[model samples]
Target: MSAPEIYEDGCPICKERLENGSDVVQIRQKGADGINAASVQRGDNVDVAAGCKAWLNEKFAPDLLETKQDVVDNMMLHLQNMDENLHKGHVGEPKSTIHQLELERLRFVLTSYLRSRLRKIEAYFPHLLDQQRNQTAEDPLRLSPDEYIFAEEYANNMSLYFRRVALRHMPTAQQKLDLSKTVAPPDLDAFVFLQVKDRQERVLIEEATDDQEEYVIDLEENSKHLMRYKPIAPLVSNGAVQLI
Candidate 1:
C-alpha cells in the first residue's frame, strides 16, 4: 500500500515547530515504504509508524497484543496540541484543513486500535483474565490496566448473569462456570499474512497433519508470506515481522 497522506509539509504549525525545534516529528525513510513516522523525545522516541503497524497487527491477530501505550499517549497529545494551535490561528485556510484532516485520521486510528482490543477482551474475557492472573514476571503484559479492570468486571458480570438466568435452577455440581470448557481461546493456528522486517533463520513451520513433515524456512527481510500465526507469534511480538 502507498503511504498514508497524513504526513504533509504544508501545515504552518508543523513548519513553525520544525523551525523552532520545539516539536519533533519525522517520517522514517527506511522499511515498509517509509510509512513509519517518529516522534523524537529527549531520551526515547515514540514511533507513529510503529503504532500504525501495531494497529494493523492488532486488527488482524486473533489474540490481543501488547498495548502501545506510549504511541497512543503521544499521538493523543499531538492531536490536542494541534487542535489548540489551530484555534490560536497559527495556520490558515488550506493549511488548517490539512491539519484537521491529519488530526481526524489519527483519531480514527487511535479509536479503532482501542476498539479492536475491547472487542477481543469482550470475546475472550475468561481466558484473558486467567492468563493475566497466571502471568509471570518474565511474561509481557497482555492487558493494559484499564483493560484488565474491564476484563475482570466483564467476567464477573457474565458469571453473575449465568447464575441468575440458568445456573441457579441447576444441580449444585452443574452450577459452576468452568471457563476452560465454556470460553474458546484464540485460534493460534489460524492463517495470517505477514511481512518480515528482519531476516530470521530456520524458523519452524509445523505441519497441519501427522502425515506431513514439519519444516523450517528462512524468513528473509522484506519478504511476505502466508502461514499459521502460532509459530510466528513471538516474531510478531518482537517486531521482527509485521502482520499485514
Candidate 2:
C-alpha cells in the first residue's frame, strides 16, 4: 500500500463533529500542549478525512505531472531486459573485466528498481482506471483532491505497463498467446464483503434513507456486510473490520 495503513471514536462532541463522508472527526494541533513532533498523517487523533488527504499526497502527488511519454522514456532508460538488444553485449570497444562487471551490476539495479515500480503500478492501476471512466454510479471511488491531481500519473503507469511492456517487441502472429494479462477490468467498485467488529453509529448520504434523520447503526460483533468502501475505510484501518 502506498498510503499509511491505519483508524475509532469517543465523546458526543466528536460524533457531532463528523464531517461529510466521515464516521468521525477531531481537531488536532500541529505542535501544542507540550507535544513532541509526530507524523500528522496517521494517528489516533486523526480521522478519515485527514487520513484520506494524507494518503493522496503520499501515494500520488510525486507523479501528478508525469505523462505516458515520460514513463515510457524512463522505462527505456531504466527498465532493462525488455529491449531485444540486451543480449547483444559489448557493442562498442571491449572494456576491462572490472568495468564490465560494474556495468552488469548497474544494469541489475536499474532493472530491479523498474520492476519494483511496475509492481506498485500494477496493484494501484486497477483502482485508478476504475476512477477515470467517469461514469455515474451510486457508489463511486472516494478520492481526495490531491488524488485527482495524480490521475495522469496513473494513466501513464497503465500505459507503460500495458502498451509498452505487454506489447513490446512481440510479433503480431503469436501475440494472442496471452492478452488477458494486459486487461484491466472496470469492476473495481463492486461491493466488498467485510466482517464488521464494532458497535458504532455511522452515517452517510444515500438514496435509501428517505428522511433527514441520523440513524444509529451498530455493526453487530463478528458480522458481515456487502458494502461500499466509503463508510468502511475507517473501520478496516482501525481493525474494526476485515475485508473478505
Tell me, by TM-score, which candidate is best. Answer: 1
Candidate 2 TM-score, true structure as reference: 0.28
TM-scores for every candidate against the unseen true structure: 0.82, 0.28
Q: Model 2, which residues run further than 4 Å from truth?
A: 1-122, 131-137, 149-151, 161-166, 173-244
In candidate 2, what are the lDDT values of residues 39-109, reduced to their tens digit?
12213232223222233322322121112233233334432422333334444422222224333544554
Which 10-residue window in model 2 sums to the lowest lDDT? Answer: 30-39
Clashes of 2: 0
Worst 10 residues of 1 by lDDT: 30-39
Model 2: pairs clashing at backbone N, Cα or C within 3 Å: none
- Score residue 132 of candidate 1 by CA lDDT: 86
Root-mean-square deviation of every model: 5.2, 19.2
For model 2, what is the alpha-carbon lDDT of residue 22? 50
Residue-level lDDT tens digits of model 1 in 69-100 = 87788767766765786677545565566556
lDDT of predicted model 2: 0.41
